[model samples]
Target: MAGRVKFGVVGLDEMLHGGLLRASICAIVGTYGTGKTMFALQFAYEGLNRGEKVIYISLEEREELLRATMAQKGWDAKVFDDRFSLLRLDPTDFNLAINSIKSELPALIRSTGATRVVIDPISLFEGLFTDESIQRQEMFGFIEMMRDEDCTLVLTSETDVRDQNGSKYGLVEYLADTVILLRYIRSPGLTEVHLALEVVKMRRSPHSREIKPFEIQEDGIMVYSEASLF
Candidate 1:
């Protein structure tokens, strides 16, 4: 159960003392253009490279856009599509999409034999339900379904830090096993956005409290040990 899952990001790995542990829900929260989706893509790519089956679930972008983003960064997205599988959740109706995701996820996990699964910006499913309690309960059910399948799940949440605690859409933080926050910190003249991948909580693993910085390159997101260039 412990070693069945692992995160590939370097700074994050250093932060968690060895990255995300198995069968856990890791949330990467950030605002727009903070490289949240890319990080999710990187996780799935890393898993596929490791000879592990991966499933990429997209809610924000269409399948073409996602593939193009990876292609722009010089990654052969088609290679992974051939090796693993990608499921695009572009529903004509938001409610329909959420319901489809809930209904199809378990079967997808079983059919693909996916060891690593990523749901890009899980917040997209938020609008499907208005009541906070109902939303939390539904999210908890979705998370439990994924966990019961023994897949390492990476769920991304869109956050606006100007608000309180960097969590706007209810108690998403409380539900995840580990929460990694990425923020754009503004300075006097220069605006420096740093990636603070925090292990808010890890069930039985020794987690790091230090907020580390990271950078996005042609390859993908990299966790930097040293101070990044501002």
Candidate 2:
């Protein structure tokens, strides 16, 4: 955490008390269409623009498809290609993909000199192991690899359907330095997205205690200064 990485335009920097620190692992949990991918991808794009080497490890989508999605979100694939590295690894096949991730993560970091990384939809690997304990172990192992490489990691997880609460999968919340929850609140006939930033457990820094409202547009995710009543 020598040089803090600011998520500038998103207005999340203020919430984080200046942004996420280097060598820290953070989780972003949201349900489908809550803009989780957009948030994580935008962070990756931000890293590229900041002259920091980034590696986007995609799980649910292929590399090409991911690039296209970013393009539609107003990100230039060419610009991203020029500065950052992208590695797509889908764990739909479970053991094989997870093994590759465990084995190749360090090597990828070394090769790309990546200081920042985005593991989109990390919850995809939840079913890889039968036992809950084993699942936790695997996730911890992956996170450990990121820590060893001194990389700023952003992981995306799906909120449990049964329990609107954040914890359902493994000990992902326990292992992460920051836990961000994105949810859709339906009021009347309107549906809106809200972003909640919980320092959860910042190692040495202070963070916001409020769950702020964040809007996603062509420019990307932006947190509101204060809550507004409808």
Candidate 3:
């Protein structure tokens, strides 16, 4: 049974109407400084907290940096070293990157017995495909292939530089079962920036559609689902 996979963010789960459906794919799309990586990490750590094995495949940040960020949030990797698998994929190498993700990731998931998997900044993976037609075809196939796995997948994507609310390659949002959009709203005077998120889409489940305020705190991301943006 595909159950609810809690994202570990406070009110974000409420917005998701409990959590993401297990064995489903979720895309978190946002521009720079929107905390896409933070959200992905929180999802991974949450799974660990729930006694489930997790695999984090990073296409951007190195493993050390990710671990340090988690360490700052008080997650002691050593405590769950056996349950966590963190690997860094060099996006610069097209063949190797494509081969590793498309060929090795599923096998690694099964070997690790991981129930939660994250590909932080999967936009890089999408970017590797230069041809739009090929990109769409490959991503659609990739997402479908992931559906057969027992683990839930979370993919972080950069917003199209031209369109703030859309995914970079414009494929992940279409292929994923759920899409969460993160945006930075500047105050009237442009004195400060506030982060807001919306449950853009969720299949097979009810979710809150309202855009809500959120903050990236020292411990983790806190979504103020009950608060009003206006």
* Top candidate (TM-score): 3
lDDT of 3 at 88: 94
lDDT of 1 by residue, 1-230 (tens): 75745576666677677778887888888877778898898888788778888888787788888888878877786776655677777644776688778888788888878888888878877657788889888888887777788788888888854662465685667788888777655555765545445456776778766555677887777777555434
lDDT of 2 by residue, 56-157 (tens): 888888888888888887878686575677777767677677876788778978887888888877787666677888887877777777788878888888
Backbone clashes under 3 angstroms, per model: 0, 0, 0
Question: In candidate 3, what are the lDDT values of residues 1-230, reduced to their tens digit?
Answer: 56798999999999998999999999999999999999999999999999999999999898999999999998897799999999999999999999999999899999999999999888899889888999888898888889889999999999998999899878888889999999998888888879999999999999998999999999999999999875
Query: Which residue pairs collide in model 1, if any?
Result: none
Estimate the TM-score of every prediction: 0.89, 0.89, 0.97
lDDT of each: 0.75, 0.75, 0.92
Candidate 1 similarity to native, TM-score: 0.89
CA error at residue 86 for candidate 2, angstroms: 2.0
Considering TM-score, where higher is better, how would the candidates rank from best to worst? 3, 2, 1
